[model samples]
Target chain A: GQQVQQSPASLVLQEGENAELQCNFSSTATRLQWFYQRPGGSLVSLLSNPSGTKHTGRLTSTTVTKERRGSLHISSSQITDSGTYLCAMERSSSFSKLVFGQGTSLSVVP
Target chain B: SVLLYQKPNRDICQSGTSLKIQCVADSQVVSMFWYQQFQEQSLMLMATANEGSEATYESGFTKDKFPISRPNLTFSTLTVNNARPGDSSIYFCSSSLGGETLYFGSGTRLTVL
Candidate 1:
């Protein structure tokens, strides 16, 4: 069984629209990070949201430690935002060893 | 800022052949991780590399199939031995300095035929 799971395997949104991606973990996470991966490319760090809410530009991430859930909100989606979003978390006792989710593939259309 | 770089962006190898992927970090890091992704799918952890000791491989992965060496704090190498079609995938090397965020390299795309 996967420790971290992402919702809405795929999403399609129009430009200027807002979209939310969800991540649920079966175990408690001491650290959580969000990443974006373009088609045929590497994964890039988007936000490090261990707990509470964090906002940067038009992207916001909220993580609920107790509930073992995390959410990433994208506002005014752009074409460049079309990619796969992944959520990864690490256990408290681990030395930053991360377990990744399946990821949500999002496409922003004009 | 921590940056990781991988060598041989892409390569095509014959079956049973071997290939080596290198990961270098801009600064000294404690640990590095190797991951494999197939067809833009979910990433699977292959192994964890640390300086001055043998690499730790995850279940379903063997040191004989994928040998990892951490010569120093800032450099590591992963070698895929006796490659097969199943070995084809994009390999990424990542490291976290002091934070939980793992910074990944550009990744090496391997095609085994």
Candidate 2:
């Protein structure tokens, strides 16, 4: 079974609109992290939320440990925000071994 | 954040040939791991390259086919032996500074003909 699952396989938004991405994982996951991959294939770490809600600029990450789910909220979307948003779950005792979701492809247009 | 540089950003090779991809981290990191992602697919962890020890491979991956060598904290090399078309994919090397946040490399695009 897949360790991590993301919803809304794809999303389209206009500039200045908001976007939300969801992620669900198994109970075995110790931590959850969000990443953005450039069209060229480079990955950038967005945020890591274990529980509660976190805010970063126009981005917000909320994680519910009890339900084993998390969500990323992007406010005021911009053209440069168009890319693949990925959620990863960290497992294992040592090292940050991650299991990734299929990802949500987001396209922001003017 | 640690910056990772992968050699030969992209490569194409014939079937049955072998190739190696190297990862170098700007700063020393505690752990470095390898991941494989097919076109339009999620990234899958392949193995954990440990310094001065054999890499720990995940299920469906073997050291014989994808051998990894981590000689030091900031350097690791992954070699693909007996390459096949199915082996073509983007390979990423990631590192962590003993924290939950894991940084990734730009990735090496491989094409096996």
Candidate 3:
């Protein structure tokens, strides 16, 4: 079974619109991280939310450890924000072992 | 913050041939992870390399297919054994410096013809 899971395999939004991606884990994770990869490009770390809420630029990440779920919200998305967002989780014992979600592909049209 | 460097941004190899990918971290890391991502697809965890021990591979992946070596804390290598067209993908090396976030290398794109 996959330890981490993501929702909305694909999404399309208009420019200046907001988009939300969801992630759920089956195991108790002590570590959680989110990443973004542009089309045909490498991944960049967006946020590392292990337990609570965090925000950076137009991105926000909220993690509820008790519910084993997390969400990434994009405010007033732009065309540059179009990419695949990945969520990863790791158990307490496997500090370095990260299980990744399939990711959500978001496309923002201008 | 730990920065990871990977060599040979891209490579084209023939079937049945093999290739090695290297990863070097700026700081000492206890473990290194290898991932593979197909075109427009999600990353798949290949194996976990720990210093002074054999790498642990995930299910459906065998050590013979993807051999790994971790000589020290900052360096590791992953070899694609007997490459096939199906193996063509982007390989990324990452390290976790005891943090919630794992720092990733730029990734090596491999094309097996």
Candidate 4:
């Protein structure tokens, strides 16, 4: 069984629309990070915030540790934002491996 | 932030044969990990490459099947012995600075036929 799960397995939006991706974890998490999977199967780190609201460019991540859930907001989306977004959680912050969610596929159209 | 470089972006091998994938970090990192992902699936952690010591294996993974070697802080290798078609997947080498963000290599796409 997967320890982490993501919502909206797939999503489609207009170029200017915003998207809200959700994540839920079954175990205690000391760190939460968002990543974008490249077309070639590589991954690019977007944001890493264990809790509270953190913003970087067009991406914002908010993790509620007590609730065991998190959300990612993408504002003013662009076509280039089309890809699979994954949310991963680490049981501990000190050099621990991450358990990843299934991922949210975002397709931004013009 | 640390940058990782993986050699042989892609590899195609025959069944019963073996191959080695290498990962090098631009800067020294305390830990490195190997991950495997089937097509359209999420990534799964394989093992931890410990510097100056034998690698640690995760569940369903063993050192005999995927021998990992980390001679130093910046370099590590994962070798697949007697590969099979079922072993085909994308292998990623990753490292972190002991905190927030994790860095990943471009990844090695392995196909066994």
Candidate 5:
């Protein structure tokens, strides 16, 4: 079975501070996606990056396929950013099936 | 991106009763996936549904316990048989359209007593 590991299980940051989240996979993945879930809410896709670096607004995702690792960076974090960030990977053989990491909980304070 | 609409945003049922959750995709998709999430936990893959075919369940999930149907490409259903208190959890419906990114529904929160 494939496994995804997320670092910094939880993080707290002051508003305007920067946050960095890490994700590592146990096996080769064909696809990697980042998701944000608010308390008692559904997951919202943040970024989908299997390799290289991608940016959307103040959020950036970088993935190194050969190393089986990925990272998400948030600049000037805001209070609305408080939530759980999850990383999911789809193995090369599994097609659309995704294996999720434990997730990194982020709390931003003013 | 496909938008998934799930019915019965929340449900409360007595033990031993059966529960069914419906998921409808706005556009046609190749497959639909069902995932379970416990309180403060990550998502767990339950099964994969394809049109006109029997769903492929993951380990520890049985067809008798959780039966899935994909009669068409735009619709699917999941039924939990003989529900128990332990069955209380959030169930999410998701699908991807020929890409890596997946779109998810709001999810159904089930509480069994």
Candidate 6:
């Protein structure tokens, strides 16, 4: 069974529109992190939210640990923001072994 | 924040050969992680490397197939032995400062034919 799951496998939005990505897990997580990656590129950490809400630049992440769910909101989508958004979680007892979701592919069009 | 440098950005090798990828962090880190990601798929944790100890591999991964070495706090290496076409994937090395935020390397793209 997959421990982490993401909704809306893919999304598309205009340059100025907003996008929301959802992530759900099956177990209690001590840590949750969001990452962004361009096609054929490396990953960049966006936000780390185990619980509650966190904001950075135009990105925001909210995680409800008890509910085992998290959401990432991207404001004012830009072409540079077009990439794959990945959500990963670590079990409360584990050391940093992250279980990643399938990820939501977002494309920002001009 | 820590910076990780991975070498051999892309490589293509014949089946049955071996390949080695190296990752060097700008500063000392407590642990480093290895992940494999296939095309259109999510990242899968391969193993965890800690300095001065045997690497801890995840389920479905073994030292015989994917050997890792972390001799120091700032460097680690992952090697694929007897490579197969199925082993083709992007391998990334990541490390964390406090186990909350993770920094990733550029990734090594391997192709076995």
Per-candidate TM-score, chain A: 0.94, 0.92, 0.93, 0.95, 0.95, 0.94
| Candidate 3 lDDT over residue span A84-110, tens digit each | 999988665554457789899999998
Relative to the true structure, how large is the alpha-carbon lDDT of every model?
0.90, 0.90, 0.89, 0.91, 0.92, 0.92
Task: Write out the backbone clash pairs for model 4.
Answer: none
Docking quality class, candidate 6: medium
Q: Against the true structure, candidate 2 has what lDDT?
A: 0.90
Q: What would the per-residue lDDT of candidate 4 be over residues A1-110, giving only the tens digit for each residue? A: 54999998999999999999999999888878899996666898999888999999999999998899999999999999999999998887654568888899999999
Give a tens-digit lDDT track for model 5, residues B1-105. 889999889999999999999999999998899999988888999999999999999888889999999999999999999999999999999988876578899
Residue B45 in model 6: lDDT: 93
Identify the runs in model 2 with alpha carbons over 4 angstroms from their true place: A93-95
> How high is each candidate's TM-score?
0.95, 0.97, 0.90, 0.97, 0.96, 0.97
Worst 10 residues of 5 chain A by lDDT: A90-99
Q: Which window of 10 residues has the lowest lDDT sum in candidate 3 chain A?
A: A90-99
Candidate 2 scores an fnat of 0.83
Candidate 6 stretches greater than 4 Å from native: A93-95
Cα lDDT tens digits for candidate 1, B13-73: 9999999999999999998999999985788888889999999988899999999999999
Per DockQ, what order, best first?
2, 6, 4, 5, 1, 3
Task: Locate the minimum summed-lDDT window of 10 residues in model 5 chain B.
Answer: B95-104
Which ranges of candidate 1 are over 4 A from the true structure?
Answer: A93-96
Q: Tell how far residue B52 is off in model 2, in angstroms.
A: 0.5
Worst 10 residues of 2 chain B by lDDT: B95-104
lDDT of 5 by residue, A1-110 (tens): 78999989999999999999999999988878899999899999999887999999999999999999999999999999999999999875344568999899999999
User: What is the lDDT for B34 in model 2?
Assistant: 94
Off by over 4 Å in 3: A93-95
Angstrom error of the Cα, residue B105, model 3: value is 0.7
Cα shift from native, residue B2, model 5 (Å): 1.8
Residue B90 displacement (Å), model 5: 0.4
